[model samples]
Target chain A: MWLTSKIKQLLMVMKPGVVTLNYPHERPPVPANLRGQPVFDHQKCIGCGGCSDHCPARCILVRDVCQELRVMLYDGSRCTYCGRCADICPEQAITMSNSFEIACDQKEDITTRMELFMMTCQRCGRCYEMEKTNAIDRINLKGFRYDNLEQRALIRKTSETFDPTLLQQSDQYQRPSTKE
Target chain B: MSKRKELEAKLIARLRDDVVCVEKTDPRTIFIDVKRAGIREASKIITNAGARYLCSVGYDNIERDGTLGMIHTFALDDSDQFVCCRTSAPENDAIIESITPDLPSAGWSEREVTDLLGLRFAGHPKPKKLVLADDWPDGIYPLRKDVPHNLVPKGAEDVAYELDEAPPGTKIVPVGPFHPSLHEPEHFAVYVDGETIKGCDYRGFMTHRGIEKLCTTQISYNEVPFIAERICGICGSVHATAFSQAVESAAGLVIPRRAEFIRTMMLEFERIHSNLLWLGVAGHLIGFDTVFMQAWRVREQIMWLCERLTGNRKTYGMILVGGVRRDITPEIADDIRRVMKTIEDDLAIIHRAIEKDTSIHKRTKGVGTITKQQALDWSLVGPVARARGVDIDARRDHPYAAYDEMKFEVPVLDSCDVWATLVIRVIETFEAIKIVRQCLEKMPGGEFFVEMKDSIPAQRHAITVVEAPRGESVHYVITGEDNRPERWRVRAPTFPNLQAVPLMLLDEQFGDFPIIMGSIDPCFSCTDRVAVVDLQTGQASSISKAELDALSRQQQARHASLKG
Candidate 1:
């Protein structure tokens, strides 16, 4: 019984000889739909902040510098590459590029920053376009957000309109102290 | 009368006025609110009615009612229903009667709630610190509504978890927080008398990332499926599907039929890959490299196919709250069929090779024997339970997604050992292939994704179970004011199966430890540092990674010399 089993095992081993790829040297073709690093189109962006609202990892940050300008920063260091931002983008501005080979020495290599010129709505003073049919898709944080871009922190505070005091306060945002 | 009404009548008859109310949330779920004093009696009544104990869920209701809520969930498998016994205690006096005395499997759930929510289980047998770090400060329960999600408390040095006392005339052998045999960072202190094992104690959840708390507080309901998919590396789609179904059931959302078929296919794909991965790991545990190599070689096709079907290779990110993100195009369906055929042929060759091997039989045949009664007591799931003859499969019993229409056989073996688990997994792999083919053939054409018409109402509770490749994964959700859930509890299969390791290790050879533990297919991550202490002298000191590596090399050399 042992001998017969050994012979069968030998056949199994010989059948799949050397199936591993030679990785970097002999590259396999990546599929077209592979969710890799996300790229943002600054020209097509409407500063809606839908992607930032829907992001699971909270890697995308939206800060309204003023009524006219909005700063969107994609911190690649914490990004899960789940392609959720690309899926939730109202405009076809965010695309998941097939760039899986994105290991880098500097964080800035993969990070994307988009500064868009916003055309604010006269009624709300914010540029977000809510889904007319589904109320659940509405953005939670309205008006203007003052997220700290330098520290990569989401302040979770918003004003009715763009507030200078809030922007200045968030610029010096520190992590909640343990000493309290 | 229906099973729900019948069970409610039984509970009411036994508990009398202690049964506060019975609410049938859905066709398959019955939520019974009982007084805190009669929780143990209520659980006993339910168990006597042939309902299997699932897991316990605890949440903070102090803001609204000044009480802490606890729900003990159970599955009436024969009737395709779930019975959730809900009870609460005021914040000033938050104590509940322990159900672990009646059902041993409730031990971890009660201990976890105690550690996280500060709800004391009065008569829990061994309620040591289960989920929290030793240095975590007292009187600061992290699961409460007042606690912030990102609070990091100060860490205390020289803290160690106390292991259970070894049996008389037996020495304790520690295997991992970083042992070579264990792929993950779990610590098992095995007690042995010479070469025969006496008992064992496990201290895991070392890599618990507080995912449940984070999802409840930070992310929305729609974003949680992605986070839930990341709970386990192997069963990504299983957790995602389970969480989505929980939310869908809570909001009374009916998904399209094609979406259900696609979800079924994705689950079967995961099962196929996971079973083959376990087969490979099992072979490697028994020192058979050929089986490991050939099995994984066959399993690689499915990973690539998933990469094409979904976007990524693992963590498919395909499942959402309403439905799946990607549709099964006809071309992709054909591609799946081609891959399935190739995998079936290759796996058959490997199975025939390993089935009658004497070396494997010697290693695994009677190594981890546990009776079916012990399995029932521990409430084991998946292949582990099926191997020991506790015939239960959540897919067939509960019939989630498209499984109600699919035809397949759940194989049960009575050998009650590691060998039976191996055989069961192989047969299940073939069964998974059959399910996938049937999904492709019977898939209806319709919309894959559904848009939620309105925001989910608050305080609606739902429970869902998806049979993951490893075992059954139970997800419980309660909708909150915000887009996120009020409380989401995830019970992975390893949570219960690992508790029974001490029982399975009794009277077995110490060398068979790796295969026995590997049979459960434990999924966890690694830890960086290790501390060594001399129990005799009461002295403790830390060891550097370099010294630990050199010591392990020396041990390996000594072991090889003895074998030679």
Candidate 2:
């Protein structure tokens, strides 16, 4: 009877297959609803600083460097990643990304800088880069020289409004050379 | 029905200090405010009324009243009333007569007051540092009005929580801020005479995050819950829910009925997981590999459910002020119900196996018996208090969140041993399951959160208590004009219960010390440590893990040889 009981216990141990994950080699499956670091959609950003103000950790810095409203930065360090910013985003522009493995050697690498493109100015009828326009058009950009001023302005304006049609428009309407 | 009235009448008549106000706070407890000179006489009068002195804590009331306030509680055995005798002293002369002579448990309480508030405990035996580091600057109490807000009390000091000069024959054993045996970081110096622990003094200053101070400085009222939740890795939800409830009560914010149900669900889920974790640890401590494996296997079920529902296995970031971060959908609720069924089946088997194990009986039975009277006098709470038959559970007594609607039983046992505590926890797991089931069925659908529109008023104070898995978590919030608590006291349950460990471990075997300490369910992250010294300086060799293992091996070999 004791031998049978011992065999039964052994069978209980042997009944299960190996359940441990190969953690590093093959990544374990994360749940669909896992709340990770906040991912900011630069295209939808209004530069209202709502996400920054709502963030308890104050890890986000959204500033209109001049007035183009695209100069935004988020610091991974000091961010609790509590999903508050994602939860409070009016535009659904901020969502928690499933990228928890965020480690870097340098301080600059930690504060990931994701810049947004400028949309076409409705009033100017000319394409201008959001950040570059804020620097050059709005803030009297004299310190930094632009080589291809028109192209830079076009790229900035297209990025600001974030219209896919703007990229198609750029392809269709290329500027004619002055000599031609 | 008039039991409270009768007690109040007696207190009023006996004291005869018409100047001080005495009011019944609870059914059997009276709150009394007397002059500093009247404390001793008042305490004696209350004690004569079949009351035992619980503990005295000093609060820095300079911002409000320009004086330091000391409050103490005395309780009766049969009655629920604990007469709270309070007195105040000026900032310069913050002194109080020590009540250690009347009540031995007040030894640690007086030491805490002395360390935190810089109060002089007159004629207290060994009023050394209890919770502060030894090298903490003299006259700079972290909880004092004079100490400017920013400076934290730091550095190791020469004070031991319980100072014991090692006897000439006894050898001192130091077990770590970093030891294999200790899962948490704590420095414990054990003075052992052979196998018996002559004195065990714990000192730790490593895990100090200054969480309380951080809560006050950085987080807003709505955001404070989530910030406080990150204090401990294990019981994050408990801290978060408790802190949130406290702020909600203070602000008079009416939480959505659905939000209350979600909060209760989260809290019970936490209790189940935490208790399961403890069961695993206890099993591991007693050298029961199979039992440990079984406990952990069941624990993973709960962990999986937590991860699925709240998105984290450990820290469930599901708490928000006036609401929860995420509400459980119908599909997710079904998954939780399924998970609960599996856990219930596993727990039934585990419970029977644990109860039948002779090794468990040998190891835990009558090992750390804290009698009913001692438990009450020490102001102990949670399963530890319940095991000793003190009959105090914050969940039942102080109904917060949706607990008022939920039907569940609070597990209590009179054994007062390690076994009794284990039984209470086991029973509580079922109660937690009952709560979770009720919550799932009754979860209402509504908006999860309310927008904080009003700014925090300045100079307004509010006290709120919530039942965490461990015990009552009290949060004292004093809001500033800018809508943030200028001074927030995040009083976790572990802070008070950790005080009773030294008293519990008295006369216990050195080998059994770890298990006894573990029985209390201590959270060392909130606690500050002090370094203890052996006054008699001689290089004495101590017991090592290798030596202990070798001895056990030899004993096993001898037994096998004799049987052969």
Candidate 3:
């Protein structure tokens, strides 16, 4: 009986392969709705600094060119891969990416920064257009009657003057970039 | 509400007015701040009041104002109420008096504090670098607040610390920061003679990450959860959970019920896997190959369950500030339940075999005994303390998430030996099963995450502690006006339990050193960056238990060589 029992135990060990996962060769199923690093939607970003303010790691950087506050920048190097920035975005402008293979030799490879263009005003010098692509398209797109290449040129030229100090004094002077 | 309250009340009366800062933080644990001058007298008063020395000293640099805060904490008997004695020292030249004479466990914690914070503990019997490598510079204390947030030091700078071998009569054996036996990177300089271990110096490379400074200067609040979860590979869930809780608390946001249930489930799943991992490690340490194989096999079930549920093996990234990322469908829940049932059956076999196994008994029984007195003095936490019959489970004592509603028992073993710790862990695995089941059954229906529309409230500070697999994991957050936390402190369980290793290993046999030290399921040194120092005299001369055993074996081999 002892010999038979020993034989049975040994047989049991060999009868079936242990349920080992042959990973890399056979990929396991990744569940849907996996939260990874944040992916930026440059067009929808408002440069509101919400994601940067709400970001735990302070990885988000926002640079405003249109004064209408269109573009936001993010450095992925400092990002903790926390999905809070995506969850907190009011415009639903950010989503978490599954591409977490962020190992890089250079620090610059890890940083992620983005810029969004601002909406120019139709009648006034002020920029107020947001979420109205038609109005922005009619004003800035080349084919439209109200199209103004000058406004786009001015927006491009004076973007460097969108510094916090310059943004505060925009209405104080009639001109933005030019001394005249 | 029991003897603990009575003793605490009696002790509080005798303590000097300015000497103690008493406040009740958690239900079971008391947070008492003792002045620097009263460390000796206060410890005596505490001992007379039936309190034991839990651990010795470390510093929390409150701000970059360039003052390093030195803190020594003590614990009362049969209670989680710990007293912290603190004093301010110079950031540039951090020095403080050592309390190792009062409590032996302070010996290691002080060495760690000395290594990381550059605090010179005067009168410490064996003050040496316990965490940072030998080549680390003298003045670059990683934990100091004033450390320029961006400063990464020149590589391979030698530390100013000098290593002296334990007094000549003692035999010294050195273990590893990279030993195959230990699950994490920790080194021990053990001194032994004959069959007895005289003393030990617990060392590691912990302070390398510059994590705290990085959190303040580089990473924002939303990004901190993922960085914090990387603090420990095994207990990543709780690290993320606790960090999120701190941030949410600072923002004055209460996560929804469904989110809480999901968090609870993730935490319990983490607990199951962590405990099973330790089971396999402990089995391997005792040379029980069958047990190791079987335990790891069972652990694979938990890991698979985690992967199926969370989509990652070690770093499960499901946690958010207000809620978790993924939700378990009913089908997924049923599948998990089925897998857990299979694991539960296997654990029963492991428990029985561990209890009855002769080799395990010989290896673990009556070895590395930490008496209740010693445990209390050392202020140990998690299963290490529970094995010694101290009932302080942060989940139960301080209810967080779905833990308050879950029904489970806290395993306590008064034996305070390696065997008792294993038993406690095995029993707790069953309890963790109970917790997971309760969470699954009672999981409420609601939104998975709440969208935070409003800006974060300014200057609000909040702290949270979660029961990580090893022990209480704490996250303290001080939010900036920009809605991110200005300062975040994540204290893992091993931060306290690692202090108790010297006490556990003292007077034990050199042969039994590994298993005894392994008794405390230590995680890695905190998210600190690494600096290596090479001592001219002590490079490989520092002794290890295995080295001593090798010496004895060498003698035998020489005798055979001579005869042959």
Error of 2 at B334 (Å): 0.6
Q: Judged by TM-score, which candidate is best?
A: 1
lDDT of 1 at A176: 55
Candidate 3 lDDT, tens digit per residue, B1-564?
Answer: 564455456556666463455555444444455555555555566566655444443445556556666555444434444454456666556666677777775676677677666778778887666666575556676655556554445544223335455867887777776676665556677787877888776556534566666666554455666767777778888988988887776666878998998898888888888888888788788776666677788888888677667756667778877788888899889988998898898777566545655667789988878888667666677888888888778787667788879888888889888888888888888888888888888888988877565657655545566888777776656676433566566667776677677778878877787788777877765523222222122336778655654665576677547433
lDDT of 1 by residue, B176-211 (tens): 877888987678999999999999988876777778
TM-score of chain A of each: 0.91, 0.51, 0.51
lDDT (CA) for every model shown? 0.87, 0.66, 0.64
Looking at model 3, what is the TM-score of chain A?
Answer: 0.51
TM-score of chain A of 2: 0.51
Give the winner by DockQ: 1
* lDDT winner: 1
* Regions more than 4 Å wrong, model 1: A122-135, A177-180, B525-564
Please identify which of the two predictions, 1 or 2, would achieve the higher lDDT against the true structure. 1
Better of 1 and 3 by DockQ: 1
lDDT of 2 by residue, A1-180 (tens): 445444544554464435566988888767777777677787776444445544566566532322232445677766777787676555678887777777766545656555544332421322112322211012111111111212211121223433445445544544332122
